[model samples]
Target: MLALAGLLGLGGTVAVQAADTPAATFTVRQLTPETALRAVQAALTHCRGLGYQVSAVVVDRAGLPQALLRDRLAGAHTPDVATRKAWTAVSVKMSSAGFAAETQAGKPMSGLRGDPRFMAAGGGLPIEAGGSLLGAIGVSGAPGGDADEACAAKGLQAIADDIEF
Candidate 1:
């Protein structure tokens, strides 16, 4: 009798707990390896066409490099610069150009330059789809930060058609 009572109570408690469980969902969009490769290639092509030896890097949402491409003469350290730019972009979700501008202005967020991973340059841009940030792209080894940014923008443009806003 006592064993039966305990079993019934346990069953009731389990049912009550299940009924009280919350129904929450989490979803996100991410880039494929093929997409990352294409982005890097597009950036490389754009920079090459402009007579610039540049490096491009694509990073995932966590700021991890997915792909990196460097021109034959992009310099030995170009890849590292590109990866850092990508990491900075994804870490803050702000174009490195925009971040540089803000940091230069010295306002509410003046300490942006203190972070080692943060770069106040123009070659980093966040990649987003449907208001969700998917990753980032960065270019380096161009004549200037603005020029590097142009290459990074090309990378993002290459994949814009297939992704949402």
Candidate 2:
């Protein structure tokens, strides 16, 4: 029971009045809008430095958008795509690139693509620290999925230290 409390403490541990009692509630970590905005900015800047116009989106752990940015020259579709990618990352708890690979045509998981909200692109990455998922970031319109993924990685790297707590 003591060991269980330690393991359950991501944001905080659940209260266990007795060994046989169930926890009534649990705490969870969440990303702030400021942090989410910073991630999107870093991703967008990285794409711009590479001469690729793009859009970036950050979604909370619950798959809700916290921040979003679209470059002036980015295609209108980029914003929606970026949001979908971020939402998908948080929803699936994995990088969109990995999801794309797993759900490729003829793959057993390909049917997941049928969901309108699931964008199996490479620009999405889950934001995690200390084994807890805080949010996710996504980038789009960077020439290719690989480039978009790289930009999203930069976004995550930018805030790695801040999210550790």
Candidate 3:
């Protein structure tokens, strides 16, 4: 019985040690400056091809704007809106459509929609690599959210080789 108790104590100690020590740390890879710039340029090209003046924004994993560009004729609010949309996507790690669906279903997003820097619309896309979220890209002022999203998708596709998704 004493031996059994000792074994149990040893097992408990090992379990506690394992729990205290982290097995691994998770690190998310982010987009490089060149890749981010390319995404913005691609967005611009796609929007121009559709004959729409638009703004494009790229945000880092933490939802901070890294790069932004607006067409000369784009609305004054285009840049800000695009940045907010990008922030929303990066924060949520999902497409704006997914976020909208969740919001519409009455899911709580920690008041993200109420935050000044968040946009729940469908013009934002999460930049992912190796099943990890890197950042997001948003396009705005393209006549409609779908149009803006399409342009953003094209931009992401342009950098598909460099990015994970």
Candidate 4:
């Protein structure tokens, strides 16, 4: 019985074990450069349609900028603003406008404002599909945060059909 148990790897330090086999494999969806560019274009067009002259930024799941589009008349700082918004959205996995509201003065999350990379503003929205986060989009140079958020929403709509969740 002892020999059988040992051979079966049921006991002892020199016990045998079952051979390893590859188990589960995962397929994570990523935002391609073309998709990122398409999102940027859609955001820019949406903002322009609203006479916003905004800058749009698309960031990957890691909060890295994948594409950016700035209107000719947009302020020089618009790109930075847009990029920051996209980063905030992907990093936190939520809308920048909501984050802003939650981090306002007197809120428990106010400390988040201390982070330079964290922006408590609107215009940032996370892009999610099939329950997986793809990336984010942001718009800046609009007259207000709401306007910027609207443009960002339009950007996400451009690729809505391509994602599943």
Candidate 5:
């Protein structure tokens, strides 16, 4: 009986050890400079095709701005806003609408709004490929947020073949 009890205890310990092991953590890969430039250029071209003067921004996985450009006729702050919107999407790995929902649930992320680098708006989108997050693209100065988001989405779609997220 003693030997049987000891074996049971050992088995229980092994079970607990298995349960305690943490799951593997997946790391998001940052976008390369060339990929970032391509995304930005695509966004710019799309906006121009729409006859819209706008600014577009690309950000790496860490939410840092990689590239930002404003059309010559865009407002002075267009580039800044676009960069902030891109940063918000990359940092949170979600669209600005998701952030807004979280805030609406009494989880105030007003701190993000206060930060000059964050823009919790609809013009930003996460750049995901192969079920992994690569970064984000943001467009501003369009006629509306929907239009801006459309341009950004087109940019990501253009580089779909090159991105593995």
Candidate 6:
């Protein structure tokens, strides 16, 4: 009987120790500057091939710019728009176009567009790998949002194998 009680007490102590353990940190994967530049370059190239002058921006997981590229003939407003689009994608872990569709006028999330950094555009895409969000890429100044999004997708495809691990 005493041995059983002792074992029970030991088990309780172990449980207490486990419960007291502190969860002090978490791990996150982010893209490197080289990878970001590769993405932007590929995006820009794709847009150029399509006869669209555009700006592309890559943002880290924290929604900070990692790399930006603007074609020679891109509009002056493109860089800013591209940056905001990347910011919006990383901030929400979703494509900016999907957000735009889901948050259009009269939708429950429509108010999200009111945020200065939230761009309801199609050119933004989350950069994901092995189920993790590594970053985002955005392209602007294409003839339309669909064209812009295609350029961004090309950018993501350029780095797909590199980030697959």
RMSD per candidate (Å) reads: 4.2, 8.0, 5.5, 5.1, 6.0, 4.3
Q: Candidate 2, which ten residues in sequence have the lowest lDDT sum? A: 7-16
Q: Of the candidates shown, which would achieve the greatest TM-score relative to the real structure?
A: 6
Span of ten consecutive residues with least summed lDDT in model 4: 10-19
lDDT of 3 by residue, 1-165 (tens): 687679887874323346568866676687888899899999988999889999998999988888898988999999998988888888878888677777754577645566676777889999987778889999999988889999999989999997655
Model 4 alpha-carbon miss at residue 56, Å: 0.3
User: What TM-score number comes out for model 2?
Assistant: 0.86
Q: Which parts of model 5 are misplaced by more than 4 Å? A: 1-28, 105-116
Give TM-scores for every candidate, taking all chains together and pairing residue i with residue i: 0.83, 0.86, 0.81, 0.83, 0.75, 0.87
lDDT of each: 0.89, 0.91, 0.86, 0.89, 0.80, 0.93
Q: In candidate 2, list every pair of residues with a backbone clash.
A: none
Model 6 ranges off by over 4 Å: 1-17, 20-22
Q: Encode model 5's per-residue lDDT on 1-165: one tens digit a residue.
A: 687679887884323336778866855577788888888888888898999888988888877778777887888878887887788887888886566566553466655656566676778999988877778899998888788888898888878888853
User: Which is the winner by lDDT between candidate 2 and candidate 4?
Assistant: 2
Candidate topping lDDT = 6
| Candidate no. 1 TM-score | 0.83
Off by over 4 Å in 1: 1-25
Candidate 4: C-alpha lDDT: 0.89
- Please count the clashing residue pairs in each candidate, in the order shown: 0, 0, 1, 2, 0, 0
Candidate 5 matches the true fold with a TM-score of 0.75
Clashing residue pairs in candidate 5 (N, C-alpha, C atoms within 3 angstroms): none
Task: Residues 75-98, candidate 2: write the lDDT tens digits.
Answer: 999999998998889888989988
Residue 156 Cα positional deviation in candidate 2, in Å, after optimal superposition: 0.8
Residue-by-residue lDDT tens digits, candidate 1, 62-148? 999999988999999889888888888898788888888887755767687888888788899999988899999999999989999
